[model samples]
Target: MNVSLQIRDVPGEVRDAIAALAAANGQSMQGYLLELVRREARVARNRTLFDRLAGKRVRGLVVDDIVTTIRRGRDDPDRADPDVA
Candidate 1:
């Protein structure tokens, strides 16, 4: 199911700007606004999700610093085992 929104009393300049942008992108004004809205929503969802995953013991990263620090009981090559035990 889909519904439409009505934004009233918008300034002429704002409407014109939206029209121009939509034209530049070869989309209708509705498509332009929907795309912008969808993009923002995706970012919001990612932030909320990653925030929830934020703190448990994690592995230290290499390369461009992506992975978090290593949790205990994980054998990393950098840490040598004692007596090969």
Candidate 2:
């Protein structure tokens, strides 16, 4: 389903800035706004997924532990394979 959205009583400067951004990106104002809304929706969906996983255990693994292990591996210079280059 598609619906039209209207912004009432917008300040001239803000509206102009949005128009300039849309033009610079080679999109019409409507297209630019639609993209922005779609991106925000994806962010919201990801946040909801994270919230749902906040307290549950997945195979007895802690999220923080997983993150720390990944970071440690990333930060170790010796982990890089020079021969690959």
Best candidate, TM-score: 2
Q: State every prediction's TM-score relative to the real structure.
A: 0.61, 0.65
lDDT of 2 by residue, 1-85 (tens): 9888888999999989999999999999999999999999999999999998976746878889999999999889889766697
- Candidate 1 scores a C-alpha RMSD against the true structure in Å of 7.9
Put down candidate 1 lDDT per residue, 28-50, tens digits, no spaces.
Answer: 99999999988998999999988
Q: Per-candidate RMSD vs. true structure?
A: 7.9, 7.7
How does model 1 score by TM-score?
0.61
TM-score of 2: 0.65
The window of 10 residues in a row where model 1 has the poorest summed lDDT is: 64-73
Clashing residue pairs for model 2 = none
